[model samples]
Every structure is written in structure tokens, then in C-alpha cells.
Target: MDACSPVLVVGALLLVLLGASAPTVSAARAFFVFGDSLVDNGNNNYLMTTARADAPPYGIDFPTHMPTGRFSNGLNIPDIISTSPACLLSHLGEYLGAEPALPYLSPYMRGENLLVGANFASAGVGILNDTGVQFVNIIRIAQQLQNFQDYQRRLAAYIGEDAARERVSQSLVLITLGGNDFVNNYYLVPFSARSQQFEIHDYVPFIISEYKKVLARLYELGARRVIVTGTGMIGCVPAELALHSLDGSCAPDLTRAADLFNPQLERMLTELNGEVGHDDVFIAANTNRVSFDFMFNPQQYGFATAKIACCGQGPYNGIGLCTPASNVCANRDVYAYWDAFHPTERANRIIVANFMHGTTDHISPMNLSTILAMDNTRN
Candidate 1:
């Protein structure tokens, strides 16, 4: 594929209402996405957390304009993944596994449904275990990885090893998480009171270790192709900087934590590939640099408001919940965030653009499309 060629993946030229201009992704198959609020469609109804999207103004710009349990004004990451024809199987992590009914897969996916993936990204999920204590009950990355394990086992039984391996190998697994780990552990939980008590160095290794566990579990389950997205610019989030430390400068403390965390994340990825005895174990999605570049110089990116979110009031001030009266914005595309904590659709698109390049983050060394292209070889 030519780097300079048109980035469009599929021509999904099908009109919305008999005749309409539309952008389409290239043809591919299978998308298994995991992460926090960014990718979750509606899997948290089983939990007991106030941090939820099963409410209004969350999916106002989406097809049904319904909340759908996503933590944004419109399409979150999972929607973006399925919209592309290149996707085959889209799966998310839902709690209670079998105790609760599996969430409904979306209905609009064309020409085969593209296997809409359900989200396992619980709102306050983080790399560490204790991040969502206040929520009473929530889905963490480790638990989600365990669910993947169960899904893989079931697939193995039904399809047999060789065929199962082939399918999983040809598949694309997108894992986007870690922000709440920083926020909840470093600032929200007991850590806030223990501010000077702990250092970034202290927490970095533990989280990296947990991340490795998740990767190893995925590989053991049948994942031959993986796309691990780095936590986007956290300190730049309206939730973080607005209320806690609004000095207009990025939080060196938190930024330093990410800096420490990312390299370790990359090193572990490199190590995972090594353990898998191949260079294709995963793609590192360098989201941190992409976001930092835009944040430090918003003027260069044509975004006038970088530090503040168009959504709320107070410190990093994504400090409050997004109720109907929260004063939603008209053009989420122009703003960096829909609410204080989440990125707007436009920012997500740009991030996806960089992810499509395959080098923007440590999660994918090659874009997910390229990884799926490899699946063609195995097929």
C-alpha cells in the first residue's frame, strides 16, 4: 500500500437515504475491541457505578441519538471500528459474562453485519485493580482479559484448534485503556490523600506488569494479531487539568507518569513479540506523542481550545457528570472534548488516522488494516 495513497479503506458508497455522499473504509474482517469508556457501547448496566452513559446527551449525534452506554455525545471508538467494512468480528467485554444477557450488537452494519463488537470498557476501568473502588463494582482490564480467555475457549471447542487459531490469527484485537488508572489511583482514591506518599516510578511497574498479563492472556486465547492503543494525552484531559491543577501547563507529575509508563509499555510489547517468537505480536499505537504534539501547540492543529473542554465547569473541570442540563455543545467536531473527560469525535478521528498509519502508538506497529491484511496470509 502506498503511504501517500488515499487513506480511504472501503467505498461503502451505499447511500443513507437512497442517495447521499458517504466516506467508506476498505474491506477487512473481524474487529475485537477492548478498553474503557472510549470503546464501550453499553456493557456497564450490570455494574453499580454513577460513571455511566446509559443516559442522555451521550449519543445525541449518533444514529438513534441514544445513549447506548457510550461515554460521549456520539460515536465512540467501537462504532468507528465497525463502520469500516474491513472489520469481521466485533466483540466487547460485558460483566457477569453469562449471568447477564449478552449486550445487543448494533443493527446498521452492512453486507454481513461486520460482526459488531460489544464493549467491555467499563467507565472507570484502569490498569490497576483498585481504581474503581468508589463505584462499588466495575470492570477492570484484568477481568476483561479473563473474559477473552473464556470466549477463546468456547471458540476453540466449537471450531477446533487449527481453524480457531486461524480465525483468531486473522483477527484484529484493539485494546484502549489506562487513563482511569492514573486518575483513580494517582488522584482520586486514597492516592489523592497520599499525594507525596507515592511516586510515578512506584506505580509504573505494577501497571506494566498487569498490562503484560492481559497481553499474555490474549495470546494464550488465540490472538495472533493485536492493536494496543496507548492512553491518550491524559493530563491534557479537561477532567484532569481543569479542576485539580489548572495552571495551563501540562501536569509534569502526571505527564512524567505517562512518559514512564509508555516506554515500559513499549518495552513490554517488544518483549511480548519476542516471547511469541515473532515480530508481529502487536502494534504499538503511539497516541501519547500525537496528543502531546496537538496539546502543546493547539494553534498548529487549528484547535483554539486545547486545555479546556467544551463540556463542563470546575477543575480539569470534567469534574461533574454530563446531565441533560450540562450544557452540551453544538459542534463536537470542532472541540477537543465532548465532556470534560472524553475526546470529541474529530479528535478521535485524527487519532484513528494516526492509528491507521500503524505507528502513532505502541499498540500497533502497523495499522490494524495491515494486521488484518496479514490475516489474509493465514487464511
Candidate 2:
């Protein structure tokens, strides 16, 4: 996240409509990040949190079968961003003090030493202050920024202040979260039990207010170019389907929750862009979709297996997790879901392509063209 100023807030974006020219080139390079499990490759190794991926079967698909603290079987978004040349930062001989012959969870300091950026996203984190207070000390948005500052200081020490500043300014700031906020807080545990006592409308607004603090902090901390991914149609997860007896039918309540959150989040971006007087610094990546309107009719979605996951039997039906009696699917590509909650690596790849291309219907930046046009708008 870099810095933004007052430029595109008050309809200054209308320049394109008037056949105006865009900026020359953006000055960012270091993709500093902060969020939950989706973007977290490691970094949490230093923290004593229960929501850890420093175990087996997590990185089964990764190169050399290395478990790099990612919850997935392979590289997550941060790694994808680092794939580019200039943004490519080494994960050895720096963050960990020195490269080691064997990689282990205790020495997670390896990847954090990269120049592209480090991921501070932890699993089970939420926008609200106390969503999973007892389960583990998840990194909240505020705390995530604190870590980002520390990252900045370390980078400055190693590469010098000016270079570090330029790297951060030019690089993308990727922040993916909001799933745990709804799932763990409003739906599970203390909140779920308490939700019955409160109106969902009342509860959601309270959550949004706290989320605002996170955004404000990022903008203040000089995170100019940001990709804030909004929550998707989460009600479709196998666990939720099982819990609510949904039978592959979308939980309208959950859909309503997404509807409530996405638009408000967009407006927050607009207001923040205005508040800071900058162009579209905050682009909301929409992750909600039913894959060609098929999931709505489940029959139309064309899977006889929507109700039960291809992996487990009772609840999540996911085989790959650290479950004792997991059901591993032979062919994972056919199934839309990989685990109870997340999509398959293939699905995520497609989604990332969509996130970059902005072609999918659910979460384009206003429209894909709007984003394409903004590429020319940089100055």
C-alpha cells in the first residue's frame, strides 16, 4: 500500500469520458500485504496462533512439496504477484537471517525477507475486534498494519529508506479478507449464539463500521494502490449447506449479507478516494458468483454432487484437510470445490485470472473496462 492524494474523488474520473489521456506509469513495486488465510503464505510463523498451516498435506502440490505456511496445496496470491521479474524478491538469505538446508515452520523468516512483500494474513481473522478472541490471537486489521510498519522498517534497514519507499509506493497492495468476519463472528460461536438476540441488519452495520477503521488506517499508512477483495456467495460452502440444511440451495440470508456488504464496501472506497482526494486507489475485487447462474438451480449448475463434497462424508466432505478420516478425491478438477470452504486450486486460478482480467460478472471494478481504463489513468 502506497500513498494517494486528492485527484479522482470528485468525478475527476470523467476525464476519460472527455477523451483525456492517462498517466505515464505507476511508481510501485513492493506488494506489501495484510489480511487473512487467503493471502497468507507464511509470516504467521513468528506468532503463536492455532490457525496454522505448518503441517503436512497443505503444500502437497507446491514445488518440492514444501509447506510454506500457506493453507493451500500450493502458491497463493502473494507468490503469484512475485512471479513477475521486477517484483520478484528472494525468500532466502535475508528474512530468516540466512538460508537453511531444510525449511521448517519455526524458521518462517525465510519468505518474509523477500523484496516483493510479505503476507501478514492469518487464518480466522476478522474485521470486528473480537470475532475469534478465544480460539487464537488472529491478526486483526489494526495489528496487521502494525506488522506492515515493521516490514517497512526492516526493508528500509536492508535496502535503504529511499529504495524501500519507492518499492512500496510502486508495488501493489493486496488485501484479501472478510470471510472469517461473517463465518466465524456473525455465524459461529459467541456471535452465532448472540445473533439470535440481535437483528442481522443491526449487526452487519456494526461490523462495517469497524472495517472502516482498517481502510482508514491503510490509506493513512500510505497504501495507495489497493486491491480489496469482497466476500463471495459463501453460503454455498459445504459446511454451511450442511449446517443450515440448504441442500445446495443458496442461503438467501447469506446472499443478502453479501449484497449488503459489497455495495457498502464500494461506497467506502469512493468516499475514501474522495476523503484522500485520489483516483481509484481502492479497487474492490468481487469474488461472488454462481458460475453461469447454474448454482441457483443446482440442477443447472450441472453437478450431481453439489450437496456432498467429493471428499468427506458427514459435514465438510473435504478429504484434504487434516481430518482423521478424510476422503481424498481421485480427480479434483471436476469438482468445483476443493475443501468444505475453499474452491479448488484450479478454481482459484480461474478466479485470479478473472480478478486480473475483470471479466467475470460478480466482482469487476464497476466493469472490467473501468479498470482497464484506469491503467491509463495513473500519474
Candidate 3:
């Protein structure tokens, strides 16, 4: 079943809310991003890591036709979310002004541009410090939080301490992590340290506990509204399908891992919201089930098959990194995946569109569109 019905079920509510007049920004909302490659724009480009995606065929669909270190052929989820009209940033763009958040590592990140926001996401890092140790030089989640602290310090120097704290408090935060913890850590080398230390039953809870610390740190950093994304369809990705499936079926074990993780993530967020004494502060996005719709029923989403990647080689073209030497597909929009593990830009757009408007379990409590609309309406 298509988890995101393009047609809004609550049409009357949408019409009433979306039809409202725009609000003046007392302060422009900043956006901060943290996580793995799914949301990493170009932070990995500055790092000396093989996990980098700055190459041809990786950004063939991008406007520049050159890689910007995004894993997708064009835009990634954060790009879509920031550029969408449903985002508070876009509304603020009208007068208060808006610009794409700068990569935290960029030297160009100084001055007024800091007001927009900053992307601290690294391609290979995860919730655990050791999750993607293979990709040396990438920033871990703990380090990302420290970097956020440093960012606030610099912003305070630019504006003032009080204004900087206020900007961060009103900012929209996006974080995507758990996928790498599973794909790059537990299942990384077979008999990886994490898997050896804890069985699946015990392992997941440990991850959730560690994740709580990360979220708490984010809140402490003055982030008031955060979109905490669950993992994607881990088992259904072309890489996992190629390695585990002889019949092009989603890998059951990994699927079970994701199924185990996502719900726990949702419940944890619910509990965290209660603990914070606010219902909307930590919104959970059920990305795993949402992506499963396109993966399992590719044609319905205009994809020929989710099992084959648009770039790379071997079974399903999913064996290794997508280089210029890889077999590039003619039509990117019809392929669910861009490389072995990452989704195509087209696929990312669809997933983000759902994030903007998807209802019920797809995006718990409320979706991004509703959140932004209501934020504007109340102001």
C-alpha cells in the first residue's frame, strides 16, 4: 500500500490552514542537520574518507553535473526539505530572507549566512562513535554535537549570545542516523564487534538508549523542534538485496532489524516528548515503512525495479561505489536507487514530499507541512 496518499485525507483542515495568510517572521527560523549520508550534503567532501561521494555519475542529474558530495544523483532529503514551501525557511525567505544552510566545515560559513543554519552531517557516522570506523576522518554524532556547540559560539560572536540562542531554539532540526548503525556497524564485516557484543534483541535497546543521549544533547543545544527520522528500508536496498537475496526479495533479517528499530524509535520519541512536556518538539518520521512502499511496489512509484541501482556493477549494480566507470542508467527517475545503497534524487524527492505531507504513522504527531503551517498560523 502507498503509505503516502498524495491526496490529503484531512482536506478541510489543510484548506483552512494552508489557505491562511502568511506570517511575518519575528526571527528567521534556522535549520540544523545531522546524520549519515542520507542527509549529508557535502561535509564528507572535506573529510579524507573513502565514504566520500564527490565524483561523476554520482551527481549526473545535479544541476552542475558534478558531485557536491551528496549521495544522490541530484538533491538529498535535507535539500528538498529546506527548499520546500512547506518548510518555515521558505516562508521566511519572502522577507526575512532564506538561503541553503552552509556545510559546517566550509570556510564560507562565516558572517550573516550563519543565520540560515548549518549542515553538520557526515556521510558515514552513526549514533555510536564506532559505527563507521572504517571511514576514518568522518565526524561521529558526539563530535557533531560538539561542533554544534562551536557553531553557537561563532554565531554569538557574529550576532549576540542571546540572539544566537533564540535562533537555535526556534530553528528546525533534522537528524538521520540509525541506518548506518545497522548497515555500517552490526552488519559491516560479519561478526562485527557490535553484533558480537549483543544479540539483536539486546543490541537494539542499547542503540535506543544511546540515541536518547544524542537527542537530549540536541535539546540542550536549544533545538526546540526536531524531525527525528527512523531508518529507511534497510533490507530492501539494492546492496542488501544483492548480497542476501537470490530471488530479489528483501533480506528478512535486516528487515527484522529495521522493523525492531523504527517502532522503538517512535515510542522513544513519544516518551521523550512527554518528558520534555511538549508534544511537537520531537516528531518521528517512519521512513522505513514509507520507503518500503516504493521498494516493494516500484512500478507503482514509476520505478522499473527497486532491486537494480542506477549506477554501479555486479548483481543489481550494487556491489561497490558508483564511480565514473560504473554502468549508468539512461533514466534516473525510473530507478529507485542511485548507487548500491543510496536512493536516487527522484526517490529522495518522493520520500521528502511524504515527509512534508504524509499522515498518521508515516510521520507521527504531525507532518512537516502541518508543523510549518501551524507555526505560521499561530504566529
Q: In model 1, where do residues sit more than 4 Å from their true spots? A: 1-28, 84-118, 153-165, 189-198, 315-317, 358-364
What's the TM for model 3?
0.89
The positional error of residue 331 in candidate 3, measured at the CA in angstroms, is: 0.8
TM-score, one value per model: 0.79, 0.76, 0.89
Maximum-lDDT candidate? 3
Write candidate 3's Cα lDDT for 1-379 as tens digits: 2222223222322332233332323356788999999999899899899889998877787544668889999878877776422233332223213445668997677776577788999998989999899999998999899999999999999889998988898789999999888898998877989999999988999999999999988998999889999998898888998899888888887898999999999999999999999999999998886688887778989999788999999999989889989999999999999999899988887888788889866897999888887876876
For every candidate, C-alpha RMSD to the true structure in Å: 7.9, 11.8, 8.3
**lDDT score of residue 84 within candidate 3:** 20
Task: Name the candidate that leads on TM-score.
Answer: 3
**Candidate 2, 1-379: lDDT as tens digits:** 2112123321222331232342311222445667777777665655687776766555655543556577665556555543422111231112111111111112322333335355667766878766666557667777788877777787788778997776676556768767777777777654475487557777667666777778878877677778777886777666667666534566567667777876777777777777878746777777765432324444443444544554455665732244425665666555556556655554565556566555535553454335535643763
Using TM-score, rank the candidates from best to worst. 3, 1, 2
- lDDT score of residue 149 within candidate 3: 99
Worst 10 residues of 2 by lDDT: 95-104
